[model samples]
Every structure is written in structure tokens, then in C-alpha cells.
Target: MARTKVALVGIGKIALDQHVPAIAASPDWELAATVSRKGTVAGVSAYTDFASFLAERPDVPVVSLCLPPVPRFDYAEAALKAGRHAMLEKPPGATLAEVHTLQALARDRGLTLYATWHSRMAHAVAPAKAWLADRAIRKVHITWREDVRKWHPGQDWVFEPGGMGVFDPGINALSILTEILPDPVHLTRARLEFPANRQTPIAAQLTFSGNVTADFDWRQEGPQTWDIDVDTDAGRLALRMGGNVLEIDGQPMAGENTIMGEYPALYARMAQLVRAGESEVDLSPMVHVADALTLGERVTTVAFDF
Candidate 1:
């Protein structure tokens, strides 16, 4: 099989830390070019604009869009129209309607489109899903807290309208929940706390049906935490370190590191889609975020600095 030539847009933190390394390690993909106004990866052709990158490398059949959700649809539409397969970073678009539009465009063009949920590829997630398949779930609790200053220092876009401050990380927890749960659950109640200076929330408390509840806070002073605990009739299940490790009844279970596993799995899935001439479009995760915004009650909190 010929290697798929790919270009990356929006050389942000995630693109540099995760995607770049993942692509370099994947045998099926070659990082052909990059588009970013501020940063450049070593040894890769870098362009200040997407137009120049596309113009110079028209033969690159795949484009991975790593930009924030606000301006995603336009670029995704252009990529599909140009007959290139597209890989969209999570929270696919700012609005659910735009995501639907992208899906339609991909189908019309017969191009492969991937809306990736990197968290769903977590190591312990699949095993937990399999273990709880036959048991009746009683309750679920999620706690995801991190220091914005430490993780996203100087990332101003997170507070902008359509930036999805806390939801940026909270969406990962939701994605994992949606994948692990056996039954469908919808948001019943939600309270969002936004820093007085920002358009998006800094903390969110959400309740879901099937007796499931989630608490997501993106502002922690020190020592980050990401954990999910579930109580079932059979036993107790707990996932720590963002689902990279699992514990059952206070005992550790073997697990894989999804940070290293996600991109390779993503490339494999993309290859399969391109080979079959199909597009994989699932917006349930993003739909929940939009629904939360439309239906959730907003509260003002202390203004955030940095």
C-alpha cells in the first residue's frame, strides 16, 4: 500500500505534542506539509496560509484540521470539495448545524471524513465497557480537574465565544462515557460557571439519566486529577489518569496508554475509510455540548487571569 501524504493545519499545542509524533510513527502516513502562522515543525514544509499549502501540495490527499472549532467548517468544506480526505480534531465544529453540513458535503463528494474522539481510544475504556455489559449500572461519578495555567498557558482562544473553555476537556470525558455506557443517556440538568471575563464556562456540573452524574472543573491550583468511578450491582469500577488505568474493587487492572494509541488507531481507521470510499461521521459528542449550551443555566464566577 502506498503511504498517504498528509498536511496539518493549525500548529497548536495538541498538533505539536500529539499529532506530529503520532504521524511520524505511523507507517501508513507521511507528514508532507504544515500550515501555521506562528510555528513550524522541523524538516517539514511550513506555509503561513492554508491556501498556499494546498496550492503547493495538491497531490496530498489527506488534511488533518487541528484548528479551534470556530473556523473549522469552512476549511473542512474546502478540503472535501477539493477531493481530499479530512480528519477533524474533536469538538468538530462550533455549531452542530455546521457539523451536519460537513457530513453532507463529505457524502456528496464521496470523500472520507473523520470526526476523531481521541479519548474514546483510552486503554481501559473498552475493557470496562465489556465488563459492564451484562451488569446493571447503579451510578456513575466523574471528576476531571486541571490547571489551565499549567496545561494551556496563554491560550486565549479558550475563553472566546465558541471556544468551549472547560468543555474542551470535559468533552473528552463525555466521549468516554458515551462509548462505555450500554444505554443512551441525555442531559437532564446542567449548571455552567463562567469566569466573569470569558464567554465560555470554566466549570460545569452536569447530571444525566440512568443515575449517572458528571462534575467537570478545569481550574485547579495544583496536582491535576482525572478520574471516573462507577458502582454496579456486581462490583465497583474506577478509571484513573483519564482512563489510561483502571481499578476494580480497589485493585489495579492492566491498561494501555491512549495518548500513544490514539493517533495510530486514527490513521488505521482513516485508511480503512479511504480504501472503502466511505465517511465516518458521528456528532453525538458535539451535539451534547451544543445542547448543554442551549439548555444549561449560566452562572458568573471570579474572573480568570492567564
Candidate 2:
């Protein structure tokens, strides 16, 4: 079977760290080209502008966009308009309306548009979901804390408007939560802590329906934390290390203990969606983030640098 050609649009940290390696390992995709002003992969065709890439590389039937939320919609819209299948990174777009528009455009053009939630692809997430399928009413608590300096380094765009600040990482927790829980949940209230100099929050406390609550912080300096605990009639269930580890009643369960499996699974799913001529656009996680921004109480914190 021939691998489908794919053009990766953003060659920044994530594209280089995850997307490139995943594509290289996949049996279903070829990294035919990359479009970025300053980032490029060895031996792959590179284009600084998206328009030229679209014009010259019509053979690339699929485009995977890893650009930041703010500018991602334009590129996605252009790719769908050009009659190519498109895949998007987490949080899909800065606004829900734009993603909806892209969905409609993709449907009209008969192209696949996948708004991916990579965290939902973690190794333990499926098992966790299965465990909770027949369980009764319960509660969920998420603690997602990390040092932004360690993860994002000096990327100033993270604190800018549409960058999503803490919600950028927080949404991963929501993605996994939305996937595992048998019942739906919605944001009820939130408190967002913004750095004095930044346009977005540095930390957030969110309350959701079904007794679900989350504490997200980007200021931790030592060991990072990505954990979610669920209490049910069956027992207590927990997902640690960003849904890669699963636990039941404090005893370790069998599952992958690292975050390495997510991207590869995502690429595989994208290939399946393209082959089936289907589009997968789940915005439930992004809906929670949007609700937080719309209804969260604001608190000013110390100015953040880097």
C-alpha cells in the first residue's frame, strides 16, 4: 500500500518534537513537505508560504496544521478551499465559530477535517473510559500543573491573546475528561488568574457539572503534575502522567506509563479517517475552555516572564 502524502504546516516545537517523528514512524503517511518561515526538516521540501505550497504541491492530499490557535483558522480554511483534507491540533481554533465554519466548508467540499484531541489518544484513556461505562454517579478532580518555562520556554506568544495561557495545557485534561466520563459535563464557574503583564491567565480553577473540578497552574517549578481522579460506585479511578498511567483504588493498573504513544495513535486515526472519507470534529473539550473564558472571574497575579 502506498503512503498518503502529507504537508505539515508548522515546524515549530510541537511539529518538530511530535509530528515529525510520528509521521516518520507511520506506515500511512509521507512527510512530503513543510511550510514554515524558519523551521524545516532535512530531506523534505520546505516552503515559507502556504499559498505557494498549495499551488506547487497538489500531490499532497492532506495537510496537518500545528500552528498556534490565532492564525490556524486562515490556513485551515485555505487548505479546505483548495480541496485537501485537513487535520488540526488541540483546541482547534481561537474561536468556536471559526472551527464550525471550517467544518461546514469541509463537508461542502467532501474533504476530511479532523479536529484532533491528542490526549484522548493516550494509552490508558480507552481503558479508563471502558471502566466508567457502566458505573454510577461520581465525581472527577483534575490537577494539571506544569512549569511553563520548562514546557514553553521563552515563547512569549503563549501569554498573548488567543494563546490560551494555562488553558492551553488545561484543555488536555478536559479532553481526557470528556472522553472517559460516561455522562456529559459543563462548566459552571471558574476563577482565572492572569499575570499582570500578560493577556491570558497563568492559572485557573474551574467548576463543572457532575461534581467535576479542575486546578490548572503554569507556575510550578519542580516536578510537573498531570493527574485526574474519579470516584464512582465501582471504586476510585485515577489517571496519572497525562492519562498514560491508570490506577484503581490506589493499586497500579496495567497501562503505558509515558506520553509517547499519543501522537502516533493520532496519526493512525487521521489516516483511518482519511481512508474512510469521514470527518471527526469533537469540540466538547474546547467548549469548556470557551465557557471558562466567557464566565471566569479574573484575578491579577505577579507579572510573568518567559
Candidate 3:
């Protein structure tokens, strides 16, 4: 079997920390080239721009886009048109419309396009979904507080209009929520808080209902918490540390795995899609974010200093 030759574009923090390592560890993929302005991966051929990289390495079968959402769609569309499988990091594109466009192009070209949700690959997520399969959900509470300065550091793109701000981490919670919920959910109400100097919201609160009520909050302070609790008729279920750990009724749940292996799992899924000749481009999570933006009330804006 031949390994998929993969190139990476926009090699930034995530590309370095997660995507590159995962690609290196995957047997199905070979890191053939990289495109970035300032950084380069260890031994791979590097280019300052995607066009040059694509032109120079016509044999690379796949391209993983690690760019910020603001400038993602065009590059991804180009890769798909070039007959390469394209993998989007998260929040696929700046707008839902662009993602829809990419999906159509990929489908028409018979290419694999994966808009990956890394959080859904967390260790305990599948188990949680199975545990809740026969149960009824009554309510859900998600507290996803992280110090942006610590996690994102000097990345200013996250605060830009298309950067997604709080939704950057909040979407992970929504991903897990969407997977575990027995039925489809619709947003009922939302509140977005934007810094006076920023275009994106720094914090948000949302309510989702599908025979269950969900509350999602993103804060930038305190203990750096990422937790999701579900109140069900059977018992209260809690997922901590981005679904790497699970608890039920204050007792540790069995069969929980905390491998910190999201990127590796993502590669495996992408390989599966390539072999199966299919695309996994679920836009529900992004749609929920757009719905929050479109329908959520903007209460107030405050000053946010990096």
C-alpha cells in the first residue's frame, strides 16, 4: 500500500504542535512538503506560499490547511481544484457559505474534503455517546474557560472579525454536544460579549434545546476549565478536560481514556475517508455558531487588552 503524500499550508502554532506530529506518526501519510512564510517543519521541503508549493510538488495527494479562518477558503478551494484532498483544521471557513462552496466543489471533483472537529475525537467522547444512547437528556451545562493569553499567546487573528474569538474553544464544546445528543438541537437564545476594541466576541452564552436545555459559556480567566455536565433522568454525567475524562454522579466512569491523541485520530479518520472515497464535511457546529452570531443579542462591548 502506498502512503498518502500530504503537504501542510499555513504552518503555525497548530501545525507545529498537532498536525505535523500527527502526520509523522501516521503510517498512512507522508509529510511531503510545507507552505509557510516564517516557519518550516524539520525535514520537509518548505515554500513561502501555497501556490509555489503546489506548483513544485504536484504529486502531493493531500493538503492540510492550518491557516486561520480568515484566509482559509481560497487556499482550500485551490487545493481541491488541484485534485488534492483538503483537510480544514476547524471552523472550516470564515463563513458557512464558503464551506458550502468548498463542499460542492469537492463533490463535483470527486475529491475528499474533511472539515475536521478535533474535539469530537477525544478519548471519552465516543463512550459518552454510547452511555447516553439509551438514556434521556434533560439538561446540559458547559463551562469552557481558558486564559487566551496562555493558549493563543500572540495570535491576533482570533480577535479579528472572522477569527471566531470565544467561539474558537466554544465550538469544541458544541462539537461534543452535537455528537452526544440523541436528537438534533436548535438554538433558542444567545448573548455575545465583544471587547470594545475587537470585532469578535470575547465571551458568549448560548441555549440549545432538543428535549434538553444546554448552557455554554466561554470565559478568559481563573482555572482554565473545560467541562461539560449533562443532567439526565439516570444520573448527572460530566466530561472534563475536553472529554478526556468522564464522571457520572460524582463517581469516576470506567473505560475513560485521556490520551491527548486528537490529531492522530484525525489523521486516521482522514485516511479512512481517502480509502473509502468519501468526504466528511459536517457543518452543523459551524451553522450553530453562525446562528448564534445572526440571532444572538450583543449586550455590550468592553476593552480587551492582549
Off by over 4 Å in 3: 211-219, 254-259
- How many clashes in each structure? 0, 0, 1
Backbone clashes in model 1, listed as residue pairs: none
lDDT of 2: 0.94
Cα-lDDT of candidate 1: 0.86
Can you write out model 1's per-residue Cα lDDT over 85-157, one digit (the tens) per residue? 8999988888888888888888888888899988877788889888888889999998988888887889989
Instruction: Please say which candidate is ahead in lDDT: 1 or 2.
Output: 2
Give all candidate RMSDs, comma-separated.
1.3, 0.7, 1.6
TM-score of candidate 2 on Cα atoms, chains taken together:
0.99
- Candidate order by decreasing lDDT: 2, 1, 3
Write the candidate numbers in order of decreasing TM-score.
Answer: 2, 1, 3
Q: Which candidate do you rate higher for TM-score, 2 or 3?
A: 2
Candidate 3 collision pairs: 196-302
Q: Model 3, range 1-306, lDDT digits (tens) per residue?
A: 778899999888888889988988889999999988998998889899788777788889899999999799999999988889999999899998999999999999999999999999888888899988889888888888888887788788898989998899888888988898888888888888888888888888887775444344444567667788988899989888888888899787843455459989999999999889999988888888998999899966668777
Sequence-dependent TM-score of model 3:
0.95
